[model samples]
Target: MLRFALFVLFGSVFAGCASIQPYYTPNPDIAANEVEDYEGPLDAELVAGTNIAQRIARREAADYAFIGSAAFTGAADEDWTSAMVRLGRTLKTEKIDYFTWYAGTDTATGMTSVPVMRTSFGTVWGPDGPRTVPVTMLDTDWLPYSYTVPRYEYRVLYYKKRKEPLPMGIRYEWPGEELGRRIGTRKALEITLVVPGRTGWKNDLFDGDVILAVNGRTPTKELMRQFCRAPAGGKLKIWRDGQIVEKTISADPSEGK
Candidate 1:
């Protein structure tokens, strides 16, 4: 009688173990608002490409409207509102006229539809000890789980004027190492200096301006070379003083060397 009671007790515990369900925990940084659900399959490459394309398109359009667009990453300690305010102040300093912000959920919830089997207690045989066996049930299946993921947001800015050219006397450098770390790409070329009294255009740009993109695309070494060689003009989206300032560029005639 005692042996039978022990078997029943062990079986109950095993059943309980098999019935456990998976759970998810939300990240603190995620906002209360739940963003749109992704309808497609959970493919990392596809999702990343789509998001990147969307961001790039927005930046380009804004650059055409404002002469440039700047990008900012939210700090670990800052909330969304604080980040927006900080960016806004910088844009105001750069004399940016129109701007728009976009946000996306940093985490996605994943659930599984398939059921799975788990180890559970089985009946005891007279000759053998209590047996363990595989149990399959609806409740025993591993349920869906959720996790936090990092994503990118774009803050596109517009100038009061359109297609404004870069100030005449400025020279840009591809500050590969420093800017590469900030922008997450070594390909970033930033405008590091404005030569005093070199050109006729007003000196509106400041030092440490990062060239985010050219003609709505991230500048590559080959593209920069082409921009330098292009005769008529080229469009550029520059990050200046924490804001994106758009500018049109024409080959500098004075710097023939």
Candidate 2:
């Protein structure tokens, strides 16, 4: 009974405090002397811990640039997938392209109070010729119930995924990711990432939109790269909402030259 009451009292308070804040700190050295444009989360990739170690041992760090890292605390019951997706949407705004994470448990303390009620028998002198009456009263107990919470300290390292391994920004659907999402189920480059609040997003070009043609030419892997790297004053035909729509190209970052 005590434990149940305690939990009921503290459940809301605990849930309110459950939010995880990933405090991101970037390596200043890399921040100052790196590429200016950072594509959105669609271009970022998550790395396995073992793969990170192998890449370092092989001196292949040049393939990707180490950007920075973030440290956060999470409860033992927290979901890693939810955390990563939330982080991807927010952290990539800082231009983080690649990331890896690990965690360890630590003991943390929590405190709350449960209100207790007591029942007693009181005699009424004048009511119904002194009948026994049951009286309920607040215990006025301020005693707090305290317990320990298991906390996980998490660390995430961020990197800029160079395009050498997997092409950034866009991916083609030819036995590839998004193959099932190809426009008309035909081969096309699926737009997965676009800088938020930019001309592209402003003009209705967004992730999941498909590039059916560029400047009256069929899209190839190379052509897709050209269009994204330095697009300027051209007709970009895209497939969206089961309709062929054309977006005006401008010299925006990562949009083209």
Candidate 3:
């Protein structure tokens, strides 16, 4: 609810004005994590009631989630086409996988118009010669006459989508260091076996544990070769026993200077 008023610039005169609420409002119902686009096609159905609660109940019974809803006042001047245009915009913007709409009749009361009068005096020449006359005029101002604004409230649209399945809680570790040959030092790799618990395997690798990076890289085949062939040592960041550890790698001894 708001009120408006106006004041004359550099003058003591002030005029009061009325502020009316808008006839339509857009109401959307959606959750942050529930947002997702439909894979196939989307559609809408215009239902014929205004009971939001009942509409919600029906949606729940059908295992649907709400997307959005809106109420429109069916003003005499607002035809079906215009109303549908607004509804279409809403439906498209909401992009709900499914839609249900409701419509009904109601009224709104408010000021429709305001009438103001203006007067002026002037001298005019007529058949009887020059004459002084006072002219009065009524200004057709549509700003302030208050009245009952009978607005027929109709159509309640419901938007919804299929309920999403709950995500599984299972978390599976990799179970083996299959890429160790490319991601680990050559000596460590030579002593290592991809299979768990190989006899005399000096290299260490546990389930879900592996060397992730070398010199801030993922240690791909090319990157590992470059790091190994370099003359200076580079840091090796490894994930072991639920923690990250750093080690230094010396230039490959076989790369004789």
Top TM-score model: 2
**Could you tell me every candidate's TM-score relative to the true structure?**
0.28, 0.35, 0.28
Quote model 2's TM-score: 0.35
lDDT value, candidate 3, whole model: 0.41
Q: Please list the C-alpha lDDT of all candidates, in the order they appear.
A: 0.43, 0.51, 0.41
After superposition, the stretches of candidate 2 with alpha carbons farther than 4 Å from their true spots are 1-23, 28-33, 43-52, 55-62, 78-128, 131-143, 161-257
Tens digits of lDDT, candidate 2, 1-257? 01111011134444544475567776553443333334343333344443443332122123344456666666666654344435544444322233334454455555556677999999888845887889998775555455555665555555554444222333333324555454455556666444444445556676667777888887776776566555454678888767878877665444224
Report the C-alpha lDDT of model 3 over 128-193, residue by residue, as the tens digit: 999888888887765434343335544434344533421110011222355443444422212111
RMSD of 2: 17.0
Which is better, 2 or 3, measured by lDDT?
2
TM-score of 1: 0.28
True lDDT of residue 80, candidate 2: 41
Pairs in steric clash, model 1: 66-159, 67-246, 68-246, 70-244, 111-144
Error of 3 at 112 (Å): 20
Candidate 1 lDDT tens digits, 144-240: 7887655444343322212332334444556777666766666667654454543313335566777778788888755755565555657878775
- Model 3 quality (TM-score): 0.28
Residue 24 lDDT in candidate 1: 16
